[model samples]
Target: MRGVVMYKPGDVRVEERDDPRIIEPTDAIIRLSATCICGSDLWPYRGAEPVDHQVMGHEYVGVVTEVGSRVHTIKVGDFVVGSFFASDNTCEICRAGYQAYCVHRVLMGALGTQSELARIPLADGTLVATPGHPAPDLIPSLLAASDVLGTGWFAAVAAEAGPGKTVAVVGDGAVGLLGVLAARHLGAERIIAFSRHADRQALARYFGATDIVEERGPAGVDRIKDLTGGLGAHSVIEAVGTQEAMMQAIHATRPGGHVGYVGVSHDVALPGNELFMSGVHLHGGPAPVRRFLPELINLIWNRTIDPGKVFDLALPFDRAAEGYDAMDKRAATKVLLTL
Candidate 1:
């Protein structure tokens, strides 16, 4: 088997590795059909995380190759979409719709998807079997449901974004684009997107953004307010974890508006006094994507939403380094790696 490994920043390679065998009675092995380069993976790609020689990738849609003794929900030859955070779906936290914080959780990157085959723990809890081996066209959408689509949905939910309310989106990345989609799906009447890039602005419009702000910092806030008739939007989704993006989402929100942020936070620090006066409710973090997997799968299966449209670039799994480089250089909005 071959898997992606990152030796350090600017270095992701495909290396031959031993195939995984059942290590737990609840585990299952998958042969990836499609995987992707996520923004979070860039943290280590850019040296923001102390990544040593480790596997890379948590988003995948694949066929189950084998199953452990206790795995009943998923079986060999079944196609499935699993969450980045593996969880026992029946856990108390999962039952409460917080699978990301399942008492027993495992981050899949420690065992990545950028491989010919990989082992997934808690198969019954983590993997969602599709009705059947889907048409090739559905692969991208299902892959998105694995992470960005789910994350965007979480951001909108956290921000209290809903029908008839004005919403502002703070980033233009894939997650941000999907956030725009989520807000629109949730019934936001007005969607304002902050995007200086024309291509992103176009996609944002396609995703249902009503306005695009090209400014940054205070100017961006003013622009958002200006578009909202001097009042900030009722709900703002922050998809970028930077301080500037966070502050922009906060400052551009109405006094009682909710701010939902799902960016992977780095050095972001919020000013207490500002937040105190802003009167905006803030919530969001790495999404419990597993919680939303079932509903999202339904939406996709029914073709209600096409989140896979976010993938602008596709490459062979062996060319993952090129995919990473393209994303790092801003040449690709999102990359799909074929296995």
Candidate 2:
């Protein structure tokens, strides 16, 4: 089988690799139909995050080719969407809707889904079977549900977005863009998106953002407050994990408001005094993509929302290096690698 491997920074290649086979009674092998390059992947590509012969990619949607003996919920020939974090789905943490922290969790990203075939552990708990083999056009949207859409949905939920709430989103990447969409689906009355890119701003508007603030740091915070009648937003979703984005999220929320962040933190540190003085609620981490997979799949299946628009570029699976380059250079919002 051929898959993506990162030999070092700025050096990702598609090369022959040993094919995956069932190693656990609870595992299943999938022939990937679609996968993607995530913003997080760039961390390693830029050498901000270290890697040594790493198998790349986690977001995927595909057909089950074989199932383990104990896998009953999913089966062969079933088209599915699985979470990036594999969980038993019945664990205490999962029962509490935090499958990302499942006691028996596994980080599927480490195994890599950017390949022709891959093995998925805890298949019954991780994979969600679609209603049927979906139409070809729905593939991109369903693929989004696998990670970016689900993460954005979780961000909205964490931010407490709902009818009558004024929400602000930090960042304008795929996850941030989809955060705008998720907030809309959650019924936020006013969505303020922070973005400097005209294309992203347009897409943000299409996703229901009422305002766009191109400024960053304190100026951006002021802009958000200015748009919210000097009170800032009631809910702020931080989709970029930079210190600047995190501080923007915190400072742009009104007193007693909530700030939900889903960006992978990179050298971020919050001042205890600032947070103490802000009088706002802060909660976020790696999103339990599994928790929201069902509802998200339904929305995509029924054609109610289209998160697939985030994929501005799509390339063949073998051209993953090119996809990575486009994203690394900010030339693409998100890149979809089709098999």
Q: Top lDDT: which candidate number?
A: 2
Error of 2 at 15 (Å): 0.9
Q: Write the per-residue lDDT of candidate 2 for residues 1-339, one digit (tens) a residue.
A: 999999999999999999999999999999999899999999999999999999998888999999989999898999989988999999999999999999989898899988889899999999999999999889999999988999888899999999999999998999999999999999999999999999999999998999898999999999988888999899999998999999999999999999999999999999999999999999889999998888999999999999999999999988999999999999999999988
RMSD of each: 1.0, 0.7
Off by over 4 Å in 1: none
lDDT score, candidate 2, position 151:
89
TM-score of 2: 0.99
Give me the displacement of residue 66 in model 1, in angstroms: 0.9
- lDDT for model 2, please: 0.93
